[model samples]
Target: MDKNYYITTPIYYPSARPHMGHAYSSIVADFFARFKRIDGFNVHFLTGTDEHGLKIQRAAERKKIDPQTFCDEISQTFRDLSKTLNLSNTDFIRTTEERHKKTVQHLWNELEKNDDIYLSKYSGWYSVSDEAYYSDEEISEKENVKIAISSGSSVEWIEEESYFFRLSKWQDELLKYYEKNPDFISPKSRKNEVISFVKGGLKDLSISRKAFSWGIKVPNSQDHVIYVWLDALTNYLSALNYPDTNDELFKKFWPASVHLIGKDILRFHSVYWPAFLMAAKIPLPKKVYGHGWILSGDEKMSKSKGNILDPLDIIEIYGLDPLRYYLIKEVSFGNDGNISQDRLEDCINSDLANNYGNLCQRVTAFAEKNCSSLVPDNTKFNDEDLVMLNKFTDNLDLIRTEIDNQNINYYINFIVSALFEANKYFNDQEPWKKKDDKDRLNTIVYTSLEMIRKISFMLYPIIPSSIEKALKIFNLNIDAINLESIAKHDYLISGKPINKIDILFKKIEKKHD
Candidate 1:
């Protein structure tokens, strides 16, 4: 049996329509899931919406309808965005679904059974925007500036009947957890903040709210709806049929490998979530990475800024792979960065159009012209040939490591760099000029073509469709692109006829109409 690997994006809030940020989060998760599947893991990738929230209730009231109907409509918008992006998630969990409710209730019972849950009256600062409560110490005022309990957003006041989690008691245990597993939180910066915050102090958090009826109802307690954060977080396990321990799906994927989320909600995943799991005597997730945000020109692309980019806008213009490549290619995955059509166009022009697309076209066309429309083989190896192929393969191994680590910025350039080196070798060897020396020229052309194959395999995860087109030009089958096969470097039979190839990535010229 294969290893089980589960991953999830944060359940998006259905109050707002889907945007590029949402797509970015889901796509990151989708890519990792696909890569794991390709690497032979039985992967469970989940993405979905948090249908029960105070904001959903307000949005519904503003639209003169019940929250469920409102959520259904808004949730579809997210689902549509996932499909539009061709995300490969295995399941989509909705908070309003029966399975989710049962799971949430089951978790509540487990915590209660463990004596970690209790009824109490709550009075404190609350941010409906964040669906989080805060203490006076956590909030601060600096000359008309309102900072969050931490960084992402601010907390405002709520007084209601509620249940509390024994977070304070687990602070030392959580610290030990961080000590024992330092890689639990990623990117180093997030890890530091989480450790410092947990060391500062821990407080019992309110787990239910009574102000609204738009959330999951507390078991047998209609007056108090489950807190949106807890209810939303439960969607992760609930989708996999949790609480039914004998169920194959639940047993297989109970402890997720990675729970990817925005930097803002790092506390929920890093803090609240682990405590909940500990209380239930369940194992914590292996890793939780909070990726940075996408900023627009001079501001973060947010709903308030009216600059939140729509993925459709880009997909319609350049298609999905181009946009996907530009996104992961343009920014280093762990850090925050800016994006614009101008930058994306620049990447498409220089990197895609010039380097990758040109290499494929040149190599395939050369093989067709001189090698009688046939692919050449590198069965014979000289020192020069061996050196060039060694350099290319060295870059390929490094690229494989970078891709696995999600280091996108330098990784894509690694491909371009190797191609540049290969281009230089071809130019210096002058394969086209040595038409009479069929064997020597064939060796150069064939080696260059093999480099192209390696680059395409490295690129397959980032730009699948574009790579597919490039592979089609080589007449390579799906099996040819696998890691084991790519490593073997035996793509073309010595005299296998090759097809004529065109540009994989077209140049984007400025057309002022």
Candidate 2:
């Protein structure tokens, strides 16, 4: 109860427009934020765009506009995405913002003062597509030559250059920290990858790129600007009003609960960010989880792969909640998952429309037709109904627990199974056939109303918008239900007229050529 949880989705690079992959990550973080809120923790959820970098500069140049102008336009796209997804992010810190700029410089000065940063000349394989450095081994040769440094990203051998973070010095410290806190990185597979990379060796990472002017200046050094990672990562403390620990925001939420990033940047978050925190003598964030990438067909999605996504298209077709729910619910959060329109349609039809939606539709429809448009009281229940409802509500605590622990697939499967149990119980007790038995019909329909209320409350955290609508369809008010309310043997009152129900989720049909 005393735990303070602050979580952040890795600030997305704004060079590209918002897409399904982007939406998926932010939505997952939002889900965690919601879960923490329901668990009654003081939660601070941060999400934003990494607006300053060489990629943004390049993208701006391609668009024939100043980098800041392009960022302004592109940043709005991300802001729009938040509205589209209904993200409950507490703060959205754009790296280009004035508050973030000051925050980045403060962290830079702290690191420099601690001697963790120093001037160093750099020469290495840099990939513009990734805004990353390759240690020569990662690149390939088509015919006895390294791939010609493509993209406008500078590979010009600059012998006279900017400051470097002495990443090599903290190698042992980082390894020791990981050893002591094995749970620091999630999904064991990602943890193993980071450990192996660290064990192989640590290189003094170049923390400043003088070639790019669209970045934060290196404190008093006018010519050298802080590297994107240094600037970008500091937004964590920035949003919390860092450099002023007395500030309430900082005091309330300093050490983040988790830093969620894609596997592509494990080195940056798991390796570099902690090193930076250690240098500043600040508490490291509780966890850094490098989740798996979303794949297009069999390959990682990219612009060149011609699979660049626009989740907006999906949203316009299926509404926000369904689209949001499917991404997290269908794909296990820790691993690579393929996204196809056809698959989305199937999940919507089978899971949302058929299993979940139809259960509400038929049950409410039966109540209005046979027993009046009101929830009736169940004086007595069949043993079968009792067992099914009991089993369905049994693991309500475990569902919230699984979600908190990020066992996403396990949590979803529990709800789906519960829905199936409800469906079976409803089908077996055909109240319509017992038309002469008024008492039996009332009991059956009333039991269904209570069960529907139970399931609807359980779903509110996951799919709030849908559950709210489902409550209306059942002619029940959501204000009455709580977590404890789901498990009760009897919940509804007698002689309350129930209304006719409609489908909560309609199956989305895929277009065929």
Candidate 3:
């Protein structure tokens, strides 16, 4: 068992400000990274901006600024977002960065050296918005304008002398690789789509764009800039110091554990990325998980749609952890999910305030009054007590299995169910009624406290700040959290003083006009 884990959110395009979709991907990746870290793996988490593309060039031109200047300003918003969202990413690499440029050019030279690349002329329908080349079958005319049928984004005919990657040559090899490693593309549905597309056919890819000057230059071909997808995909490698494959960072986490991406880019990551790695003689990532979009209403969030949900606004209203919890628990991973304000408010009030927060506050307040604010000593475990406590120890392995499979919905559902059970257990036992029987009262308090510790440990990855506050009732900090400790029934010290914590969540009151 290797304990090294590497994960990445697709480096975002900086043509627009960060959106809920960007935040969702980063938060999900951060959740996995945090889980792996607490599970005893050395984790490397990467995210950043894809600053070079036709869309970015046009956006910069519209702003009346140079591409680099535009990138610097726009890219900072993403960096700020990583902080605002409380992401635990280890590195943020921009395509315009010199180090990333070095890695991209190095990959290019390697492909060229391997005869996987050739100088060629390309004529196709190109979508500047998607930064993708579409085949005739993929394009449809809408309102007298040609658009990519899949994305609904307008495309233009382009003819350019450029460099091409031998994607067609690797078509059969890629299919064989996918067949050999069935889990390479996740969620079963996405895998089927990729396999069917590859089986249909693969065209040689255009790897350079002579029209855009805002990207990494082809190694020896100064007149051409590398294709945006190729340059952007290389960020995963560049962040690890590739080309110097023997470097410690590169050697330990080369083949990434997973690349978390949006479904719209599934073709690029699942097909082109793996093919590029194979052609360059580098190991492919373990998995490419293409998650669904975060829809604003019934439609996917887009600027043109005027329905993009700003995560920052949601965080402002509900708080970060609540937002994190809502997204993680409510959204069905690998399926498009809509964000509704009413549902978010309900989640914050029901799940956060009533269930988990009330449990922590009630138990701690009871302990303060009855047990002198100290962790109580239990006399003996009753069947009921053992049953409640065993829920965690029993499912430890199952939780780990689900996390490994990226079964986020399962993991979150387990937590929600556990929280519900913990609340019910506390209510049923009636510790306040057994005040005269000190041992029984102490036992119930001890059991309740232990349940809190276990559930808080499981939740540390999702609602970290709130969990940090909740754990302080046990006088524990972030560094004290560990997944392995959850299996221990008596992890909390008997005589340790429990600190008081502020309300974890203020119930959002409903308004009646």
For model 1, the local distance difference test gives: 0.80
Candidate 2 regions exceeding 4 Å error are 143-158, 379-382, 434-440, 474-484, 488-498, 509-513
Best by TM-score: 3
What global local distance difference test value does model 2 have?
0.78
Model 2, span 1-513: residue lDDT tens: 545888999898888787777888888888787766655577899999898777788889989999989988888999889877888888898988888888888888888899988886888776655666666656556555454332223332234476888888889999999999887888789889888989998898888887878898877888887778888889898998888899988888877878888877787899988989998889998788878777777666666567876788878877887877788777877988877677778878888888888888888777777767776667777787788778656776886667656787886777788888778878888887989988788888777777777777766766777877777754566455456666776666566555655667887766899
Error of 1 at 217 (Å): 1.1
Encode model 1's per-residue lDDT on 1-513: one tens digit a residue. Answer: 447889899999987787777878887787777666655678899999998877788789989999888988989999898888878788888899999999999999899899998898899988776778777877887666554646545565777778998899899999999999987998689999999999999989999988888887888788988888888888888998888888898889878888999888899999999989998998898889989887776655666458888889889998898888877777668777677778788888878888778877877788888888778766776778777666655554675556445566666676677778777777788887888888898888888887787778767767777777788867875445665444555556787767766678888985656
TM-scores, one per candidate? 0.93, 0.91, 0.99
Winner on lDDT between 2 and 3 is 3
Ranking by TM-score: 3, 1, 2
Better of 1 and 2 by lDDT: 1
Ranking by lDDT: 3, 1, 2
In candidate 1, position 140 carries an lDDT of 83
What C-alpha lDDT, on a 0 to 100 scale, does residue 277 get in candidate 2? Answer: 91
**Residue 298 error, candidate 3, Å:** 1.8
Off by over 4 Å in 1: 141-155, 391-404, 477-480, 511-513
